[model samples]
Each structure stands twice: as C-alpha cells, then as structure tokens.
Target: SPFPVHINRQQVVHISGECCHCLRLNNLGIFRIHCHGQRGLIEAKIFNLSVGNHYDIGQKISFQLLESYEQLRQFPLEIFRTSLTILLTAQLRLVQERIRDLIVEEKSGCAIVSFQLFEIAAQLPKNEQVINILRNLIDKQAINLIDPNRRILHAICGSLVIGPKGESIDVKLFSQANGDYIGEFTPKKIGQYRIDVTCANIPIQDSPFFTEVYDPLQVHIGPLPKNILIGIENTLEINLDNAGNVPLEVIITSPSGINVPIKIDDILTMKKVHFTPTETGIHYLNVKFGSDIVPGTPIQMMVNNAHIISAYGDGIHHAVHEKEATFMIETKDMQGDLQVDIEGANSVIKTTIDRINNSLLKVTYIPVEVGFINISIKWNEKDIMNSPFTAIVTNPGNIY
Candidate 1:
C-alpha cells in the first residue's frame, strides 16, 4: 500500500487514498487516522489496519482517508472515537462546572435572620471540545480557565435568588483577599430554597441546588444560673419544641481562660447541659444552637470561694470519760458532708452528728478513757474553721 500521509501528531491524519491491502505502524505511541475525501466519490475507507495485542484505543476506530481533490454532499463521520460514551453523556458541548467549586462558609442555621456565604471559584469547562483543544496544544501547562467575572451575582444573570415565598433576596458578592468571589444572602422564610447560580445566562453545574432553611431560634432555653459553687455539677435545660434540626454547642471558659468540657443530652424540647466547675473563680458560659448563639450566652458565673464554716459549743471545752460531750456547727449555708474526728484517745471514742437544720449540726462524742482529746471538725474532708480543738477529759469519778 502507498499513500501520501500528513499527520498532526495525535488525533488527526490527512491522507489520500490510492489503494490499501494493509496499513501497519510499529514501535510508536498513540496515533489516529482522520479521513478527508470527496464524499460519494467512492468512499476512501481503510479496509484492514493490523492491530497488536496492546494498541492505542485509536486503532479500534475507523479513520477516513482524507484526499484534497474531493467534495461530498454529506459526511456523517465528523468526529469519531471508540470511548465517545463520555463525550455524548451530558452532551459534548463545553459546560461551566462551578457548582462543585461552590464553597459555603455559613454563620448559622437559617434562623429568623440568617446569613450564609458561598465562595465562587474559577469555573471549569468540560466537554469533548475542551478535550480536543487540550490534546493538540504545545504548552500543556498554558491552559487557562475563564473567570466568572461575578456573573453569579449579576442581576441579569439569574443571581437574583428567589425565596420560598417568591421573595427576591439580594445577594451581595465580594472578592476575598485570595481572589475568590463570595456571595452572601439571607433566607427570607423557613422552607426549602433553590439556589440556581448562572454564568452568561447558563446555569452552572449542579444548578437548582436545594437546601432546607430552618429557624434555629424557635427553640427556647431556660435561664442560666449566674452563680454556682465550685466542685458542683449543674444541669441546664433547653426546650427544643422546634429546634431539633440543628446541633447545640456549649463551651465554658474557666477564670484562667481555659475551655471546660460540658455534657449534652438529647432534644425533647428538652436538652440538658451539664458542666462541673473545678476552679474557684468567675467562669464564662456560652451556648449555641447551630452556629447561632442563644439569647443567654457569654454569661458570667461567680463561684464563691469555699463557704465560711463557723464552729462553737461547750463540747469543745471539756469531756468526761464514758460521757458524751456536745458541740454545734454553723455551716453558713454551705453544703457538704459534715464530719467530726476525735484523736488522742486511748480507746475508741464514739462520735455522732445530728443535722439540726440546713446550716447547723450537733456533734456529740463519748470518750472511753480520760485524757486530753483532740477534736477535728471537717467538711468534705477539709478541716473547717478553727479545727483540731483540744478538750480536757477526766474520769467519771474525778469529774465529781
């Protein structure tokens, strides 16, 4: 077989057909055979092109042998490739793919007043046309994408977002420091919203995006305590009648400016937030439903330095062997386990504590031997005010 072959490197080849028994190429990379000839003037088709076990997908395609001296009324083989499934899929026309590039930087779950942001990135065009131009270009790295020029925010380009109730929302688009365009808008009502951003009057990829607009402010939280005691675990409840869609975030900062962990319960129109204070000082509390901070947030809580406990009574003055001595403790509205310990006794001294009221306790101790006994009054394992009192004890007979 003998024919004048003109090739343009990869996908196209211009050749005039004289006659063909077999056309073979060896020890080379991918190649394509494009046909140019006078149509209906005896179709210049390659009958037998030998293929190897490992060959380019181009070989599986039938390329027409093109000749200069030819003209045809109709030619159907304008473009041909075996793997055209991808080309014919959404159509071979170049399309703007900016929807996946849409970046959302949200501030809150769509509350009564909600604002959201989306970053419009450089648009990418996809199609067979784009692939064809890229394959032949010399400087492979020189391919540049077309800028959107803020088309998604343009009023005429369909950037005017229609709200759920036919309310038109104004989308404010601005460029960031990194050259990214950001579009901001607020949902006018509580419902589903369709965001169909376009460029050059054509919808971008993933156009007509659907999202649910919810009002996180519908939930109600109970009043938060302004003061709490250190070392105590407290629980705060929130009513979630219409607030279960969004997440609740609570963060507590200690006086030393360290974040404290909090416990959260499920929504029941009821969410219990539990936190324990380890440090004694003022703490800051914050609660958020979605990205929206609840009404009562950044609350200042003062944990009063440990309660002042006062002790007084005749029991601390004297004791008699085998006789009970009495004392009274004024807790000053404090809370904890009341404890009384008696040491410096030869035998076991029986001690009893009776709660007279919320802030007072009666401590009674019966000594088994006579001597000087050491009295220690402690609350929650720590010694109370003026602890380790010394009392004089004598035998029952000597007491007379």
Candidate 2:
C-alpha cells in the first residue's frame, strides 16, 4: 500500500517488504516528499539499519527486498528513526548552502550590471550644456550686458585664481560644436561667485562679443553774447574735438528748448556748426557724443540745410572753414531805377525785390541784364540796418 496518502505540507513515509524464505529479514525504504503551490517533489532512499548488518554512512540504497523474516516486525520501529535522522541532516545542509549561493550571486550580478551601464566614453559637453552655462553666468552675475555686443566683466568674480584641485588651472568660457558649454573652472579661492547679464532670453554663446567701456567725447557750442540785441543777428560758432572714435551729435537748443537751425560744415576732421540767433536771450546748446567713435577722431565741420556761403574744400578731414555774407541788396537795373530788398534771418532769401533788375532809375531806363547790387549787414539775429550796396550789371555786346 502507498501509505494511505493523507499527509500535507511535508511528509515522511517508510515502505518495507520481505520474501517467505527468511521470515526474519526485513527491507525498508524511506521517502520524504513535499508539496508547495501546485507542484510536489520527493527524495527517497532505502536502508537496512539492522544492528547486525553493515551500513555505509554515505551509500545509495534500493527498495527491492530478496528475503523476508518473521523477526522483521522490530525492523519498522528501529529503521524508521534512523532513516528520518539521515534525511533531515542532508536536506538542511543542501538548503542552507543553496540560499547562501543565491544571495552571493544576486549581489555579484548587480555590481556587474552597473559597471557595464555607466562607463564614460571620451566626449565633451555640447550646446545645451553651453546654454546652461550661460544661464548660470547670468544668474551668478559674472558680466553685465548693455547691448548685444557690449558687455562688462566683473574683475574679481570673473577671474579663476586657484584651480579646482588647488593646483593652478586655466579657465575659459567657450562654445562647443553642439552648442553645449563645458566650463574649465580654475578655482583660485574656495568660494562661489555669480554671473549676471542684461539681455533678452535668447542666448549669445558662440556669437562675437566684446568687453570694453566707452566714454563720450566732449563738444562745445561756444559761449554766446549774454544779451542778444534786437535788430542784430547773433552769430554762434560750434566746435568739436574727437575724443573718441565714434562721432558725436551736436545740437543747439533755443531758449524755448527747441533745436535751433544752424549751418554745419564738415571740414577736415572737425565739424563746425554756425547758428544765427533768431531771438534775443540766453540760448542753450546740447551736444551728445557717441561712444562707438574711435579715440582722437574728430568730426571737423558738418553743414546744415540752412545757409551755404562758401564751402572751401571737400568736407573731409581738415576742410577749409566756410564763410557766408548776410547783407541787404539795392538793385539798379538797365531801366535806371533803384529798388530796395529786406533780407531777414530766414535760411532762404528773406525778401527779394520783384522785377528790380528791370526797374527804371532817375531819367534812365535799365535793361534786365544790367544792374548794380547793393549790400549791407548787421551782426547776430538782428535786422538789416546799413544802407544797401550797388551790384552793377552790363548788357550783352554782339561779337559777329
């Protein structure tokens, strides 16, 4: 019989057999079976543990019996205990050794897997990395941005004095191929510094950027007469010395704070602006110089649209100073008549005598081609006070 098969979890059963010849001989088999989940496995061995029989401690045994004996009744009780002890000892040793091996294998597997996954191949940081560095630069305040190409670097924070490992190292902020940023921070002092800049959100890592401070050059509109007498045109001369490479803007402001119209002559290198007073009062002159100008490059003389008298040379560096004559005209045409014209402070002809070139004077008739032009003048924003001068004109003489 198969031992009734009623045990669960773990069970041990013994099967004994005998032949009719030796009634006292008994053969025994021991089985240790276990069922876990829905699967079961069993370890079985047969042994003759009779006190008088030789039994090797480590030997394989079988369940087949050659003979049976009547004294085998005692065989069940003695052999049963002996087989149980041997099976328990062997199972315990095998399970303990296997559990330890599994633990060791699991730990070793994790270490090996990590080593394979995180190896650093020789490579550099990319554009994205560079962008991050720029962002950090702004946050740390290493530089300030006035415009796209203009920036100022902080003296102390911007330098890498000591190296990262306490050894002197070279530090540079550069752009990479992929646009990533890699920093070579040579830390002289063990401290943190910030880089700040003023610009739009877009980054300018690989672009052309320069760090230099520009100062504006000075210009003078020259001091004018404190009191501008009415009926006199006040003449003001403007002067500028190129303190910087960039050209500066020179503007003259009226007493009303409006920009006064003036004549600009761009001479050799200095730009000269001549202003005639329209009203009498203390006037303000405002001049602004651009910092982009090259140092010591002066804008000699610049001309405005107002009045043009005599412009000597091409308005290049060291051009001849210009001169304009403002005077009243008395025209005597071929018809022999005298006419007077008042020239005001306007940039154009203030007032021209109509048909004066054809007018008749005294008892003589003046032709349109013959006349005497008269001239007179007053200084500053004043009226024409002097008598007019004569401009002579002669008629055409036929040759052939």
Q: Which one wins on TM-score? A: 1
Quote each prediction's TM-score.
0.33, 0.23
Highest lDDT model number: 1
Candidate 2: where are CA atoms >4 Å away? Answer: 1-206, 210-242, 291-383, 389-400
Go through the candidates in order and give each one's C-alpha lDDT. 0.47, 0.28
**For every candidate structure, what is the RMSD over all alpha carbons to the true structure, in angstroms?**
23.6, 39.5
**Local accuracy of candidate 1 as per-residue lDDT tens digits, 1-400:** 7998998644221221111111111111111112232111111111111121121111111111111112211222222111122232233233322111221111121101111111222433422233344333312322222112211110121222221213343444443354333444544444333443433222333443444444556757665643355666666677766443455677889999988778888745588888888888788877776546777577787765444676888879787777878989988666566677787656557788888988888888887777888888776666666787888888867655
Clashes of 2: 92
Considering only N, C-alpha and C atoms within 3 Å, which residue pairs clash in candidate 1?
35-64, 36-66, 36-67, 38-71, 240-269
Model 1, poorest ten-residue lDDT window?
Answer: 19-28
lDDT score of model 2? 0.28
